[model samples]
Target: MDVGQQPAAWHELAATFATIAAALFGLFFVAMALHLDAISTNVTVRARARVSLQSLALSVVQSLLILVPRQPPLWLGIELITTEIVYVMLGAGLRVRAGITALIAAMPIAAGISLIAGHGPGLLLQVPAIIIGVVLGCWQAWNTILPAELQTRRTVTKARR
Candidate 1:
């Protein structure tokens, strides 16, 4: 079930697919780097993109371990951690502790999924993905509190003026 265990042709095909995904990821970062205007022009859009990218990066890691046979080596882990640090910086700029709890919660869930799937789920990884997806979705769904608090504080200060 794992990539190493697959037939030669299937392994080659999967490697090709992984290469394509990695290329696309690189292109996205390049575009993001080149177009500072997109973020500068719309703060809200930028904030959303940061959060989306954080979730996306986490999902990518999870997928690599569960769905794909390649359990990213140490370098990939380092790269992901670095990317997360950047995401955390952007998130903190938007809100003091934005995404912290969700990110923390995601780690164990992803690991649990991997453990359950036994490194190669063949197809059972889908179940764990659904479970983790629900958990993350719920966290986001309830993320309104922080924004609401900020808005309330702003309103209070405005009333005092």
Candidate 2:
């Protein structure tokens, strides 16, 4: 498709999110590497990290779907739905946090449906989706990567209030 054929907003949003996803993915990998031993030894940490990783993966995939050059929105829509379905399968055994990630992924599903139907906000929905994913990913990293004594100190401080 010609560059002029596609709306500027779609291309810009997709391009920006692609950048954001790449940067966040790198940060997540570093955070995980630092906490790898803790995450591996503790089942609970492993489980939480899995969901966090899944969330970051979803953000990356969603950006890629939109950034595919000149692809029709309908095709992108179909791809988003398919990706979310497979993502659900991948995170199947995970519990509440996984459920939250599933819900976060629902935005892309909705965005896809809207794009397919030729109405609604279309790719703009991805703004909130990626934002939430990055924020949650960072939150998880902070919670999962900090030293145990720091966490305990924070908890104790909070309890004193």
Candidate 3:
């Protein structure tokens, strides 16, 4: 199959992805900052926040790699896999959080392997992967911003009234 032939379309997609990923990171950062105390003191919240940022940062890196001019499919694939490796490694001590990250990284990892093999959905797979990453990141960010205890407090307060 022909690779790198559809540069124009892929570049546009990648550029858009990079833009969205960066913006999401910014929002997540603010959320993390707002709950800094909660996150620092709570291991779970801290892990979630770390995963959120890790996911967003990986998405940005993936998008940038995808945007590289005339890059070979195998090279892109290797890069994606390598990035995921680092992501997994970074989440190593997080236990279940790392599992969650591995699941989320699965799509892009598969897409990368597929690209390397010159078959399958190729770059298109990353579209959903990117969307998924964004959602997961945002979810974790929200959790950081409002941990369960805070949410429970709000609920109890409301119930009292």
Candidate 4:
């Protein structure tokens, strides 16, 4: 696949990414709802949840940009970079782990920039990067919820004792 050509295959890949990101977002929302009490009681857990949501949101936007009909590469690059900056800033205001994850999450933006500049493997690199970001986001969200649930259970057990 030529980097200059926007193939149907590439669009299909982007659409698949969008679907996955949306599904992950829905799952995260359900998990948060189920653990709302634990999440609300802890600032760190809340920040982690926020970071996870932001990452998933970024994945959806990036995938949509790729799927957009006749979208210019320059616009995609600009939007992706801008989104990464915003995400990193938001993470910086949270815990150190979130800030680190935010930096890792921006890897896709760099790949997107390379694609726009026509230097990279185009859709091949972009697709993987987007998927990785979504996975990382889901992992972060799980990390947040699981620990909180365990802590809550422990607290209940102790109180009963």
lDDT, candidates in the order shown: 0.42, 0.68, 0.76, 0.73
For model 2, how does the per-residue alpha-carbon lDDT over 1-161 read when each residue is reduced to its tens digit?
42322334466676776677678668867877765665677776776677667766777777777777768777877887787777678863253365666667788788778777767777667568778876776676566667533555676799999
Off by over 4 Å in 1: 1-20, 66-123, 127-161
Total clashing pairs for each candidate: 0, 0, 0, 0
Native-referenced Cα lDDT, model 2: 0.68
Off by over 4 Å in 3: 2-8, 92-102, 148-161
Model 1 per-residue lDDT tens digits across residues 35-119: 5454445555455445434544544543443333443433333333454355445553243243554554444444344444446
Q: Which sequence of candidate numbers ranks them by TM-score, best first?
A: 3, 4, 2, 1
TM-score of each: 0.36, 0.76, 0.78, 0.78
**Model 3, range 1-161, lDDT digits (tens) per residue?**
54332334589888988899899999878766765666788887887778788878888998899898878888888888888778778863263455565676787788788888878777777677777777777777777777845955776799999
lDDT of predicted model 3:
0.76
lDDT of 4 by residue, 18-123 (tens): 8989999999999899888899888878888887888788788888877777776666666767776786776632544655565555565675566568666555
The residue pairs found clashing in candidate 3 are: none
Ranking by lDDT: 3, 4, 2, 1
Instruction: State in Å the error of residue 19, model 1.
Output: 3.9
Off by over 4 Å in 4: 4-9, 92-106, 152-161
TM-score winner between 1 and 2, please give it. Answer: 2
